[model samples]
Target: MGENINFNIVLFEPEIPQNTGNIGRTCVLTNCKLHLIKPLGFSLDEKQVRRAGLDYWKDVDVEIHESFEELRKKYKDGVFYFCTTKGKKYHTDVKYNRGDFLVFGKESAGLPDEVRNSDPDRCIRVPMINTTDRSLNLSNTVAIIAYEALRQVEFPNMK
Candidate 1:
């Protein structure tokens, strides 16, 4: 991705270390920033995390926040798009821009009501088949939304 273009991938209370590591690698590949909220399920030093990232974890731009409010305070001017199954629009519907914040919630429960309600118009979701599956995997969800945003921007700086 272009050095001038940047996006933020916010994970609120991610439960799995492997997923977080995988997402971290994705961020590194896409030139996006990774924001991890507090109360993560696994320690950052866990072997699973390192194994998933495969020596690239250090290269990933990762930021840890004590809470969502802290993250909001840091990026007060950011345009946040909360990814949830209850989103009113599909992921591709939004016109993504550089520096947009793509927020995802916990694996099992998804984003809390307060968060989803915070900015209802900004909520988005991936179009999934009508099945019993409650939602997609956390890492997969991030990749889908991230790539969609990248695609809309013509894959800037990506060869």
Candidate 2:
């Protein structure tokens, strides 16, 4: 993994432990930072989370924040792109850069209107087939957007 991590994946009020664990593993493999905003639905020590992350949990650079506001305050100058179903543009439409923050909302409800609307131009979403009423799984959604951004930057520090 790279010593200088360039991307961050932020989960706001994530509900599922398994999903978070999976995302954490992805972060570890990609050398990206994982920022989790409370309140999480499951304990960080949950067995399911460990199982989902397999043996990669400890390698993940995970940061826990009390709330979205706290995270925002910490990364005051960060370039954040909120991912939501209501976003006007597709995730692929954006030209991702290093040090960009990719934010995903809770499993049940996506990002709040206030957050999504804060910078409408920075909001993005994965396209879905109209036949389904459900959105993509949280872990899958994170992987999709993360990889796209990583791809845009030519998968830095990856063999």
Candidate 3:
């Protein structure tokens, strides 16, 4: 990647502040960019976010986006992977490229059908025991997939 960013983590209307805070810490450590779509459930300000131990929030490369379309327009060539429980492929099945976009949905409702269904081939999921159980926590899910991508890319600038 030309920039310092090794990858992109796009959250489509994330709800919990703690989850976002945790994900932001991961982004800072991984040199990934975090793009938050509008209609976020909690504040990004340090006070509430610190509940998740995001003391280095300012070091995170975060961008507030008005819409997914706007983000696509900005990063026109970015390869996007939609992560959903409804995905057709396991996350590890796909090869991750540096600077690719890993798109996740909100805590309650996942990516709107339109977005997830838009590209079936690009949709992915983490292996789970049962579909009935509540899916993994948002931050955990992000960490699992993000680290897998980092591993595929040899952890980029991370030691």
TM-score on alpha carbons, each prediction: 0.95, 0.95, 0.94
Model 1 lDDT tens row, 54-96: 8889998888999999988978888999999999899999999
Clash numbers, per candidate:
0, 0, 0
Task: Name every residue pair that clashes in candidate 2.
Answer: none
Provide the global lDDT of candidate 1 against the true structure: 0.91
* Regions of model 1 farther than 4 Å from truth: 1-5
Candidate 3: tens digits of C-alpha lDDT, residues 53-119? 4566878888999998898898887799999999989999999988899999999998999889778
Error of 2 at 131 (Å): 5.2
**Which pairs clash (backbone N, Cα, C closer than 3 Å) in model 1?**
none
Q: Model 3 compared with the native: what TM-score?
A: 0.94
lDDT of each: 0.91, 0.91, 0.88
